[model samples]
Target: MLALVLQELQKSKEPLSVAALSKKLNIDQSALEGMLDHWVRKKRLIENNAQGEMPANCAACSGHARSCHCSAQCPFIARMPKTYSIAAGERGTDND
Candidate 1:
């Protein structure tokens, strides 16, 4: 049953609410909540704050990699380079 829940979560791109997951898994809402709480305690899943309620994603931003803007303003931005790395073997030296 736990495996089934984890599988569903893996297949979903967006974080699902407990109610939605319960309906999809055909389990009782309260039971599903208990299972989710267990997973949270195990650190397998995270609980986010959404308007004072627990959500499946973080409160600050959505989890989509392409859509997130936090990286642009991130503190570590200065540490990253603008160019992609090329293999040394793929480039010719000045001796050529």
Candidate 2:
């Protein structure tokens, strides 16, 4: 079942939301999130949220990124839907 998640992500032309993946795999969001977390920990999957940073002057931070507690899940802003992708460097070519 974990492998199936990787397969779906690998074959996708664009990022897929957790909600869409849950429906496609007939699994609940909670279970799907665990699997995604596993892959992310293994450095195979990149959660989109993990790659983003709030600018120091963004309204959410109010020009205080240095002191703001607005880590990835800042409540002042709405988060993007949960999504993951194979890390760029991990998608090795057969020739390599």
Candidate that would win on lDDT = 2
Model 2, global lDDT: 0.71
Clashing pairs in 1: none
lDDT of each residue in 1-96, candidate 2, tens digit only: 999998888877666778988998999999999998999899988765433355433445533445446556765564456567777766564222
**Clash count list over all predictions:** 0, 0
Task: Return the TM-score for each candidate structure.
Answer: 0.51, 0.63
**lDDT of the candidates, in the order given:** 0.51, 0.71
Which pairs in model 2 have colliding backbones? Answer: none
Task: Kindly provide the TM-score of model 1 when superposed on the true structure, using C-alpha atoms.
Answer: 0.51
Quote the positional error of residue 61 for candidate 1 in Å: 8.6
